[model samples]
Target: MRCETRLYNALNDRMRRSHGVAASQYEFLRYLRDHPDTRVGDLAAFFAIGVGATSKGMDRLEGRGLVRRVPDPADRRSSLLELTDTGTQLVHEADETFGAIGALIQTALDPARLHDAAQTLRQLLTALEHDRIGTPAG
Candidate 1:
């Protein structure tokens, strides 16, 4: 828990300083970039955040011109999110920032140990997702 908190704080701080984006926002943008035309509900589910919070976050991103929502053709009530040119540029910058931060962190760890730890964390995350442990209930 302590390690997770420290890492989260460090990453968030670095992202804020380097990209002018909070860690959550960076994460949202990253996912959106990878999965274009995703729905708000899908994003909320992916992030394990509430629908309302996801909507507000999208609103903020939209207001900043980082994200744009187009009416979903099949679902008129919902919209599909897509990154704008500015958003794409921001995501690229954030990627660079994250790479630098990751390098800094890796420098302090043994390569083998870091790899092992990352593998373990990935397994855990996969298990959690498979079991829907943190997913919100309908």
Candidate 2:
């Protein structure tokens, strides 16, 4: 757990230093890039995080001019998110960084072990999902 935490902390720090964004912010940007007009609530769901946390991440991205929160045409009170040009660039950069990390991970493990770990983690997550830990509020 400490190793995982350290890895993520380093990843986040590196991302912020190099790209001026956190992985969560990059994820939100990626989601918006792919989905174009997704709502904040939907983005929260996609990330499996609370709406407030997603909103806070979005606020940071918005401040960086990487994302825009426009009124949803279907719902006046709801905001639809989209990636700006700067966001597209940042997302691409993050993808490269992630790709490098992925390569490193892949090289560190045997193929069968990696596959087994992935399957085990997926099963664990499925079980946990049923138990519903840390469910978000409306």
Q: 86-114, model 2: which lDDT tens digit per residue? A: 88888988888766666766888899998
Error of 2 at 92 (Å): 1.0
* lDDT digits (tens) for residues 1-138 of candidate 1: 997788778889989998888989999999999997799999999998889899999999999999999999988998999999999999998898778767877998899999998899999999999999989874
What is the Cα-based lDDT of residue 37 in candidate 2?
A: 80
Whole-model lDDT values for every prediction: 0.91, 0.80
Root-mean-square deviation of candidate 2: 2.0
lDDT of 1: 0.91
* Pairs in clash, predicted candidate 2: none
